[model samples]
Target: MIVTADGSAREPNFNRHITTPNMRKKSINMMYQWFVVSLVYYGLAMNSANLGTDPYISFAASAIVGIPATLFSAVILKYLGRRLSLSGTMLLAGITCLVTALPWPANLNWVIVTLATIGMFASSGTYGICFLYSGELYLTVVRNIGLGSNSTWARASAILAPYVALLGMYRREYPLLIFGVLAISASIAGLFLPETQDQELPETLEDGENFGKKQRFWTLLPQKPSIDNNSAVEQ
Candidate 1:
């Protein structure tokens, strides 16, 4: 509909015209991104002592795992779609977890440790990008609210991560089991979500909503205003 006084149609796109249902559709998958990203911190808390000997070595060990994985994820995000990148990271991280669980000797511990380090780094980068991905998903009007809520939930997980890790450590096998389950679940969620890689920004809520709802120009454009030739002739 046109604004009667001004006569300008709404800006062309889904972001502005998007519906509540559009927003709700992707909520579950995005939440997984938020929650699972924070799990690495918990993993660190539980697994640090498993590294043995000097505490600095353990700390260094964690950092080592995180750095490369972080870099790999950050660089690949733009190149690959969000779903593929995240799914790959989680799947590999799961493998890394299983590898780390292997009964290797102290001398060969470096190999398993390296895998975990890579997983941490990859997980860190994947988690960090959620802020960017979610921010890009919504329009500017509610952009802050949308992404902020997601980030809040993700970061909020930090408060409970350590406690869970400590509690799980009390039972020895619990933390590993928990991470294993989360890793698998997140990978599945990543696989199911729609790909939004390199798509143009939706200027309004409706534009974002209709992002997948494509149509021809004639379908959206209104009829042009007609000239009153009689009035012109009388003048």
Candidate 2:
């Protein structure tokens, strides 16, 4: 047993979470992940006009696209698992945006517009998944604190998103390239986090300390738990 700052007794193992090197690393990484995700997601959203579409139409279309993307992300989260779905969508979003950033002929404006909308769709999906992922990743005791802290970072991202998009004023592709790089970076960072889809939410600091230690790659495929007993029950 251990006593906390508030003089409360805790489970004997609970103290380990406070001192665990892995836990600290994961927490710091997640902070960066949330910031990057928010920055790119909103940056693309606010700068939709750069896609060469009517700004009003693009905004409405982006909102409409998000409806289905959210529903589809639920299915993606269920089957593809959190890690792959996030990384895949983010990678797709980044690639599509980078495609627009290329020095293509003006004749390809329609292609660029199409890619921007697709990137928006992917970014929306990634943003939604992050909400679910962050909620589940934190322990009950500190879940609100963790989420609040992340939200603050997200707001910071939101504030910077507009300025980042302003780069497009100087060079049209500047914002697109920036969004692409950040989205891809977020995807890579996501790879380091554990898959949380359908898995039991961490209820205590100890559970969080041990979270993501189990390897259940590609929840899309079927696997026998005979080899690893924890596999079947983790999700």
Worst 10 residues of 2 by lDDT: 217-226
Residue-level lDDT of model 2, residues 109-129, one tens digit each, is 667767878888888888888
Q: Write the per-residue lDDT of candidate 1 for residues 1-235, one digit (tens) a residue.
A: 4454577675455555435675666665777767776775456545656544354665686676556656777777767656667777776666666556556677775675565566566567667567666776666787877787777777777766776567544653455556656777777666655555645667776776765344222222222234679978898
Cα displacement (Å) at residue 214, model 1: 7.9
Best-matching candidate per lDDT: 2
The whole-model lDDT of each prediction reads 0.63, 0.78
RMSD of each: 10.7, 5.4
